[model samples]
Target: MGLSVENSVTQSHTRTHKTFLITNYMLLGAASACIFLTLSLRLLPSLCGFFLILLHVVTIASAVSGCSIVTSGSNKSYAAHMVAMVLTSIFQGSVSVLILTRTSDFLGYLKSYVREEEGETILKLAGGLCVAVFCLEWVVLGLAFVLRYYAFVEGQSAHPRNERVSEEELKNWPWPFQV
Candidate 1:
């Protein structure tokens, strides 16, 4: 019975890990697409354009780092991943909303070399990709949390530290703290 339970847990963990990986991959693709769309606007000389591209690059880096950190299984790595994902998710959502709602104004700010209509079209496409990236970032964050929890549980079960305390060891504790 115990073996079966352990096996089931392992299977579940495996499935969750796979899902986490797939979501991160999707995020990478979406970010890349956003970069390409931004490039299509031919606004690389503009500060706004540079920052937009930088944002997508950061998103891609976060996703890549997330994939690498899974194997390290360190609390610090998990915290970093969570922080990166949250920030990127927020930024991506904001960018998408801005592009979708104020396409003309944003294009003017970008100083895109393309014609107005074409620039708007590209911005909308990038905005759609940003939305996809935003959603995928959150999903990745959730999956990372789940994977961390599973790792913690498995670690505890595999090498439990809750051994029975000896009588002498227990007696050394302060009265109120005695187990």
Candidate 2:
């Protein structure tokens, strides 16, 4: 029975790991697509264009870093990953709303060389993708938290509760710190 329970836990962990990888890959592709769509508007040379592309670049970077966060033992790395994901998700959502609601004004700001109608269409498509990226970022954040929980559980299990610290070992501690 114990063996079966361990096997089930391993299977659950494997499934979660796979889902995490798949979501990150989808996020990368969506972010890349948004960059291409932005370029299609011929806004690459403008300041607004530069920042738009930079935002997607940062999203891609965060997603890439997320893949390794599970194996990294440092608390700092986990905290940084959480911060990046939250910021990117917020920015992506705001951009999508702006693109969808104020298409013409946004195009004027971007100084896009494309015709008004074409630019609006492209912006809408990119906005839709931004929404996807935003949702995926949050999903990835949740999965990362779950993975960390699993790691903590496994680590605790490794040190059996049946083993007690000997009194002699306990007495060797620094004076005030002794339990």
Candidate 3:
């Protein structure tokens, strides 16, 4: 049997964890939709970019909440979620670093293509917004992994391992792998 935290431990953390995932996925879906809106509504690409970054800010905040929740030991599924977050954290961290490293290159690229009078301003504003969000996203996702590790270790030590696998149950699976 796995470690079990007493119900008295409080479930606020699990509630918050679920809330973050729900909000993150919903806002991310909307952001994906907004990106498509740029194809048809052509007042300004920069305006669309700004809103896109705003939506992402919400998503990243949700990620931070998820990270915090992982540290609280409120949910059993935290391990699974953190396992997934590890992959996303790596990807997001790389993206954030790339943006930071290439910010100047990005501004130059913008100057080369965007001839609008305010292109540089938009570049600074919108790119700064995106880079900031990416940076925060990287931080939280990495923290989530660390938090999950501690929770896992703490949980393992807290609960009693009373349940044992029966011979019949063991025989049902391949010898080396039993649930």
Candidate 4:
């Protein structure tokens, strides 16, 4: 009886914590997405550029809540993840190509910051570094989404449980939450 009560309490606490964590992730993702979109649109201010930036927002959304990507409320979703990756990659690729096409103008814009030759070199280096970092972040976000989707499809999901898991299952649960 004591064990049953403890399990019930633990399950409830776990459910509440899961909800809170997910909510925090979603809120932060939405806020950061707004910042990213605003900066991209303001800096580039072109139709294709806007869409490319919007894809970045979608990528963040996927990381925050891949489960929410479902259209029909189903958990099985490897195909959805594939679609997301393809679409995001297309936009990222297009943005890179577009940057290439604007090489002269981009350089001019960079040089505008500081008119010295050294300034131009610095600008080029900084811009390249920023792009590389952004691409790395995008890759990480994609990997996280893929991992989350895989867990969902395999029923190894991060769902908030209404009922207590068996002791065997509890053994597999993450540490600090082990019952």
Candidate 5:
């Protein structure tokens, strides 16, 4: 009987620890991807880059919300998710102004290198795509908010930490497959 109890407790702790790690990994991946995409914006035209930038913004917001939800309790999750969504919406939406300004300033240069009508159409389409992306992000953020709120209100707390790693100890974490 003692052995069985010990086994069960061990299994429970393992599961809790694994869940925490997975959630943390997800948030970190999202944030990293956003930063990478944001830095690559210079490779594309202003309009196209603007659309990509919005995607990065959405990814960053999602990452922040996910990290908050995983680390804090449900109440904090809802608050964090809401805040990230609002900030992303405002910042992402306004970023179109930069796109417009940049494109306008560079119009003459672009015209000299390409056909005017074709370039105009491409620019228009790119602008349209930017708007579409922003709208989609807004909708997704709303759904995430709702889901987070539902989860929070249900008293569903994640498993307790099974072990502790001091901040200083993190420096010794093994590289992938090295441990």
Candidate 6:
């Protein structure tokens, strides 16, 4: 009877922790997505740029939180989602710097002087890179959302008391749950 009580308490604690951890992950993913969108839309007024920068900061924080969860071995799908967030954050940060610094203008001038055709090619290449990164991020976001959905579904069902897992379970969760 004592063992059963202990097990029940443990299960309850585990369930609470799992939900809390999941909440953190979802929020992180959401914040990362918000940053990506805001930064991508930055234009015109420098104030927008400032907002983008702020968003980037938030993205980094989200990435960190995601990383912590991944390291904790909470859920593989969640880990994978965090990895995506980290990658997106790094790419966004670099891209933001490039855009804000007029790096493109400098590169364009250099290309134009050396080879007009080549300069146009370089411009196209840069644009293509941006598009690719943005598209990839969108894909990641979609995957994250889908994964989160699956997680929600899985958690929606109550587990039999006797079957409570001691170690975190990543089985068939979805997406990058086992990352």
Candidate with best lDDT: 2
TM-score of each predicted structure versus truth = 0.89, 0.90, 0.39, 0.37, 0.40, 0.33
**Lowest lDDT 10-residue stretch of candidate 3:** 34-43
Q: Note the Cα lDDT for every prediction shown.
A: 0.90, 0.93, 0.48, 0.49, 0.51, 0.50
- Ten-residue region with minimum lDDT total, candidate 2: 69-78
| Residue-level error in angstroms, candidate 6, position 2 | 37
Off by over 4 Å in 1: 165-179
Superposed by TM-score, candidate 2 places the C-alpha of residue 50 at a distance from the truth, in angstroms, of: 1.1
| Candidate 2 Cα lDDT to native | 0.93
Give per-residue lDDT, candidate 3, residue 105.
Answer: 55
Off by over 4 Å in 2: 160-162, 166-179
> Could you arrange the candidates by lDDT from highest to lowest?
2, 1, 5, 6, 4, 3
Candidate 6's C-alpha runs over 4 A off are 1-104, 108-116, 158-179
- Candidate 5 accuracy as lDDT: 0.51
Per-residue C-alpha lDDT of model 5 across residues 1-179, encoded as one tens digit per residue:
98897678557555544554454355345434544533433334555445555556565556455544643546665576667656765655554454455655434433323455555444444444445445645655555544445445433434345666665677677766233
Which 10 consecutive residues of model 1 have the lowest summed lDDT?
A: 68-77
Estimate the TM-score for candidate 4. Answer: 0.37
Model 5: residues >4 Å from true position, as ranges? 1-81, 97-116, 156-179
Best by TM-score: 2
Looking at candidate 4, the ten consecutive residues that score lowest on lDDT are: 66-75
lDDT of 2 by residue, 1-179 (tens): 99999999999998998999999999999999999999999997789889999999999999999899865557899889889999999999999999999999999999999999999999999999999999999999999999989988998999988998898988998888677
lDDT of 4 by residue, 47-104 (tens): 5435544665665655445444432234446456546645654554554454445544
Query: Each model's RMSD to truth, in Å?
Result: 4.0, 3.0, 9.5, 12.5, 14.3, 15.4
**Looking at candidate 2, what is the lDDT of residue 3?**
98
